[model samples]
Target chain A: GAGVSQTPSNKVTEKGKYVELRCDPISGHTALYWYRQSLGQGPEFLIYFQGTGAADDSGLPNDRFFAVRPEGSVSTLKIQRTERGDSAVYLCASSLQGHNEQFFGPGTRLTVL
Target chain B: AQSVTQPDIHITVSEGASLELRCNYSYGATPYLFWYVQSPGQGLQLLLKYFSGDTLVQGIKGFEAEFKRSQSSFNLRKPSVHWSDAAEYFCAVGVSGLWNKLVFGAGTILRVKS
Candidate 1:
């Protein structure tokens, strides 16, 4: 059985550029979540998806951040006009429905220079 | 809003010494508490969780946590820490609802001295 996986383990981009981080959740997981971790800080929730629809997105910082899980197995977090402040490690997690435990991925570090 | 607090910014303990990491959370009603460890370049790993029944919960890697409602705390403890135990520990509270949304603390860095 495979665990959660994220692509582009590390990404560096200029300010005002766009970047997309991909997450492949474990097989049969019905819930997905995205979090951001800054230096010297813990991870903060960004968005969450239940199945193909986003159940809660209040944690998204702004409109520039968006995520989609079209097929219910993979998710992509898109950032538009990235800013230096947006630089951080983007983490992806998945869990079985009705389960409290969340399995996290290795994360994609996004650097906005 | 539910929140978590990890007062200790950093802790250093000998490999054979006892270890305890304090965690306090603020949430209404019965809260779902969790302890997670994050190693360098690795994803977050769950250490233990407390929901109901016994206040003392045992978890993987010889780790355990005690939930004290009076103190609103769930502190992680281990009898003897190993050098490989050095990492960042996070205390999180899960908001009980249709989806379990986690609210995490600032985290405490643990250093194991051999």
Candidate 2:
């Protein structure tokens, strides 16, 4: 892909439901990131991946929020027992290497109702 | 931990007027600063970034930013505002040792009046 791409542009799920958001980063990029943005606020860092390993998951809100970049290209963010507070736009970004400028995706808007 | 602060929650500027958005950050060492713009229903677009050397950096779309190490600030400026420039602006700071995980400010909403 020319840029980072996220799937299921929007998702609405009931409370306590599980959801998975997908992200496909640009080819050859070694770094990927996930962020969550609430209305009227800036995007908050959620997780970061370097190659096939998660370099940083400190930003994930809790254990329920898990992300995996198995092949170092495509990544998945899975949430368990969703809550209304979890409703937000999930963004994905990719960069050629660590500490480099990142290219962002259109983002997936997840609504927990 | 690195963090960014965009003091102005909302700003309104008339078309053709000069524009300046303030940003401050807290970082332990030489910080990598960035500015991004987001229009409604759109993804974030990097305006400019400051890594090393020049304190003043020029970005795309007629945007520029100046990094002040003393004040711990990196402010975005445009010579003239356009109605099309109305959007949300975010200031971010990245830790030098961290692996590109950026900490972003709350964001400033710009409303350009024609």
Error of 1 at A32 (Å): 0.6
Q: Give a tens-digit lDDT track for model 2, residues A30-104.
A: 999999999888999998899999998889989999999888899999999999999999999999997678999
lDDT of 1 at B8: 99
Quote the lDDT for B14 in model 2: 96
Ten contiguous residues minimizing lDDT sum, candidate 1 chain B: B94-103
| DockQ scores of the candidates | 0.65, 0.72
* lDDT at residue B79 of model 1 (Cα atoms): 99
Clashing pairs in 2: none
Q: Which docking category, incorrect, acceptable, medium or high, applies to candidate 2?
A: medium
Cα lDDT tens digits, model 1, B9-52, are 99999999999999999987888899999999899999998888
The per-prediction tally of clashing pairs is 0, 0
List the candidate 1 regions with Cα displacement exceeding 4 Å. B97-99
